[model samples]
Target: MNSALTPDAVVAAERWTAHNYHPLPVVISEAEGAWVTDIDGNRYLDCLAGYSALNFGHRHPQLIAAAHAQLDRLTLTSRAFVHDQFAEFCHRLADLTGQDLVLPMNTGAEAVETAIKVARKWGYRVKGVKPGQAKIIVAADNFHGRTTTIVSFSTDPDAHDDYGPYTPGFQIVPYGNLSAIAEAIDQNTVAVLLEPIQGEAGVVVPPAGYLTGVSRLCSENDVLFLADEIQSGLGRTGETFAVDYEGVQPDMHILGKALGGGIVPVSAVAARRDVLGVLQPGQHGSTFGGNPLACAVGIEVIKLLEKGEYQQRSAELGQRLHAGLETLVGQGITALRGRGLWAGVDIDPAVMTGRRASEALMERGILAKDTHGATLRLAPPLVITADEIDYALDQLKAVLG
Candidate 1:
């Protein structure tokens, strides 16, 4: 075992906390860029990137500076009263997304809930859908969030089982099927909520032109296209938004994760004024939604994205990463799927389970996560270099061998 993999710490953590997460054995103490050091000072390359939350890398200098500067100033003020940092954050994010308004929230799930509320309200008020009859079509195998309403439509048994009585008014359709989405829509269908690229479902990218078709259908049917970009946005897929690759824009963009620059929890729903304006005063609000600290970190994140360097890096490096992973197919990898710096690799079940492959990689100083049965999800920080990518591939090859 690696010196950094502390058995005692892992045991203590499991004993103290709920069994909500089955984390790897290593105990990370500090992280910088795409690397982490455990308690024993053993280092490992971070391939998960906190599920794309660390797109700019851990403890980025500018993000840290913004956090520190905000610490000396202000933090929370709730939605009851406005704060100095609120407008700039909202405006810049709106500009970045090319939307008219923004509703800030603290987490990805909260933003999703906010979108649901806004969509339902818009359906009732604008689309003239009967109250309590507004329906939103969602994709199967989707991983929106763990909220009661969000998980109600989840096709995954692990996420759906025991989560209800479950919320209603959602229609489930197979992802990447435009015909299913079109067939599911009706007079009462308010929106089609989907992840442009299903992140947690092993970074599954939908069929080409599917998003464009969805956009056109939504426009024709007067239904909203709400894209949950929480995990796939912010330079992860080499674009500002995953839908951008298809030249498709959703009615509302639900954003999170990297929006906080890995410094704080920040998320928002960006949409046109008419769509989000359905919510009047007292309709929805959050205490820490647009707090100064979150805005500070978010502003820096937007600024970094505005430069377009990280997106370019993800595009260029992503090609190299995918090329390398592609060469591994039939050797140990059964399949590979993804874009930019994100990939879901299927290890041959004959060789080992995904969890076993992850453990082997961990022992080799590369940290990654396994999903499903034999699929590994790799999303390294955008700051990782070409040499680091080659090193990780070498380690993976050794583990599979």
Candidate 2:
């Protein structure tokens, strides 16, 4: 902004917005694969990849085609009426998640809220918990979404503060600590919700066997395990799901972000019939939950996942990414945490703040974002090649140097 007249789009956005997000001043106009071109016609490698929402990359040909075809046929029919594309996406998604049923929603936060409602109902009718006393345990530092209920359990001051009177019934526990979760679960507990890898918490991966222990503890306590895979899922973590690394399937799989294949906003909670089935017809519904356009794009997303190329690429290319990143440890980076194409890089505070590092990287033709105080979250599109990864690493090295 200081070097040039701030782009009109960026200026207008700042002039009209609520200032909720402090995004770096870069106005992207178009994108494909792993790159985006600004309105000024400068292309930068898209390192954030829309926080894993672009796992399949921007305007994926197949997904675009599906959206186009569906747009020509039908767009929104609401959940009141069933569209031809609805059941296909739901069924395929259920199959992919290996769940008995799938309930679609428009955003990840909606899916989380749906899961919370279903879990509470299940506790009342199925688990036989006291109607008003049903309790759920969540990890500290978890980022499910910014909804009021979800924010109630959020430990981050930015998301949690000013968002009260907070919802009750959620018990906070230390993430990755099986002992903490076990001690928190009581007879009135209905579920334990977690993100296998705490994406917003700087791609925080838990200790080994932590997920398995949580799964076992939930099973022993007759509690439902809800895994929020909205960010670390859909082939972003070098696996279909980060929990896949441990082969631990939660009772409910909360999915979104990449499920729309960067085409539309789509999300869903995949769970066995008994758990999600607790919702009565009038109890839960979304007008745009399973609309034709979303389902069409979602179906193509599932189809692309079924072939397994993206997951394989994440697994194989991830090594190259991390290996190069690891070399920067002492040079400027303090540490790294993540799996697959996703990473949370901690820049040495003595060297530079994450914001400064991000700006430096941006100036060098790479666009990565910062999270916490000094951590950078990088999730490049899965389609990025070896050379692109190397280029990003080289730029990062220069920025840190």
Candidate 3:
């Protein structure tokens, strides 16, 4: 597909840096499309896609070309001066997201942080909420980011405990439970932030009508529906966004991960003018946010999405993936859930732990990751072909047995 890496570049692959994969012992030296070659020359089919960060696969030609072109011209202005790529990046993103405005940031965490600030400001300025009384509702077992404020509302002990004293003004509700959300809302509630499908929580897809219900509840209570689509957006879930399955439009969108086409880091929050308009100059900003290089890569990402082929591949191949996974349920998998090319397989604990199974899969030349003890997550790059998908499934089946 993308011949971004020539033969010379492939041979020049660097050694793995230390500590990133501590104790895993897998030293990846190079990658192309849906496969990675370890330093010792072993190749593995990639199933995690760098936690969905590399949705377009490694070294996609278009994304790399944009990055190189931008490098030759301009890189940074620090938001102090306007650059040529700024408006075009933001404008295309706005149009893509079907929103009135967009505020760019450097990472998913930064985008979520921006949304939080915007929501709080909107609560006080526009919603007429009293100072220091605003609250945002979040789902349980959600992974927004590692920021102190984000982890403040995390239900996972690993992410929550010892990270305190935690921030306040947020409420936790059961994911996929509309009644719980309705019961938790109050006059001071500023927004309801959720992942359309919780990624870190073993790719948990909410119950039917869950997304639309949340949208309705937010509208009824005048609270902004903030969809943290960082992992679930950008055609990873077969649609532009996971929420599109229900045709629900969130008031604010928090996007990242694949937004930079797995090259540079680019994140943004898209919302109506009345919502993001609450922020004044100097209220909050990042020096590297919306930089020329990030924007150039982001524009290419948007253009690729506009083609609709990747999304179609995911949707079609996803059916093939799930169909294969479905046959393994009760044999080794306790449960299976996901959308598009993404899946969460719950290994039977009696057979082996998810970690051990992942190691077994790794040995079989299929790379994947385990989450929360017994659940294994698979989000292969969209560039992954049907044959590769079958090969991965065969390896997984052998591992489970």
Candidate 4:
């Protein structure tokens, strides 16, 4: 055991914070690239990457420089007044997404909520749906966010159980089933919201043609196809957006996690002008959504994506990662699913629980997260190297053995 594993720090954190999260025993104090240093002076490879928020890795130089430069000038103006960094960030992100409008927010959930609101409004105003009758169809076992309204439609008991009287107007359908989605839509249906790749449901990838089918269904039904790319976008899936893989253009994109370049909390909804333009002044706003600091960091993130180097790295390295994990199938891993640099490996439950496997990996100086029962999710920074992926796999092999 590493002598520096500070039990006292872990105990203190548990005592002080809410029990919403069950974190690993390791306490990271600093990080660089794909590695983190714990308070105990132990170094470990970071496989989670802040749930894809750190896709570019912690404290990336360009993002940090942008944040620092913005800090010296201005931070917040409350959306009451425009900041110099606002238009540029919005313009660049809009261009990058191939969308005409952007609505900035502070988190992924907020962006999702915004999308919902906009979709509903568009339904009432443009689609001629009756007021208070607009419906949006979501997926089963999907993890969008934890807000009350978002959770109301969640199939996950942990997120949905206590948080009701649930919000109405959302219909749940079996994910990756285009037939179910097609059957669910009605005259009142305003949108079909889904994750291109379900992240929290163990990085599940839909069958080929699923995304395109959803797009077609939405188009035929005159319903908005809203892709929540919060976890799978911004180079995490070896592309600007996972829906890009199918050459499908959704009506709206809910983006976050990596848009701030792992430096600040920045999120947004990108859509066509006619769709997002439905939001007039005072209809929606955020104090810190498009603040100078967030815009500064976001602009740099957009610039990085525009270069397309990170997306390229994710595509190439992701192949290496999946190939390596395939070798472990039936060894300890029972199933594997993911795209780009993200993966979900299902360990043989007879051998160990997912939590136990995560703990074992921690002991080996590697960090990963488990979901469901025996499924472990690995989403390393796009900046991680091939050698580092091999090292993490080596650690996994030992842990399973």
Total clashes for model 1: 0
Q: Show where candidate 3 strays beyond 4 Å.
A: 1-23
lDDT for residue 120 in candidate 1, whole number 0-100:
96
| Model 3 C-alpha lDDT versus the unseen true structure | 0.92
lDDT of 2 at 246: 96
Which has the higher lDDT value, candidate number 2 or candidate number 4? 4
Better of 1 and 3 by lDDT: 1
Instruction: Determine which window of 10 residues in candidate 4 has minimal summed lDDT.
Output: 1-10
What C-alpha lDDT do the candidate models reach, one value each? 0.95, 0.93, 0.92, 0.94
Single out the weakest 10-residue window by summed lDDT for candidate 2.
1-10
Query: Could you say which candidate leads in lDDT?
Result: 1
Per-residue accuracy of model 1 over 145-250 as CA lDDT, tens digit each: 9999989999989889997899999999999999999899999999999999998889899999999999999999999999999999989999989999998879
In model 3, which residue pairs have backbone atoms overlapping below 3 Å? none
Query: Which lDDT value does model 1 have at 339?
Result: 93
Model 4 over residues 1-401: C-alpha lDDT tens digits? Answer: 57545798899999999999999988888999889998878999999999999999988999999899888999999899988999999999889888999999999999999999999999999999999999999999998899999999999999999878999999999999999998999999999999999999999999999999999999998999999999999999999899999999999989999998888899999999989989888999888998899999999998999999999999999999999999999999999999999999999998898999999999999999999978999999999999999999999999888
**Candidate 2 at 251: error in angstroms?**
0.4
Measured with C-alpha atoms, the lDDT of residue 276 in candidate 1 is 95
Please give the TM-score that candidate 2 achieves against the real structure. 0.98
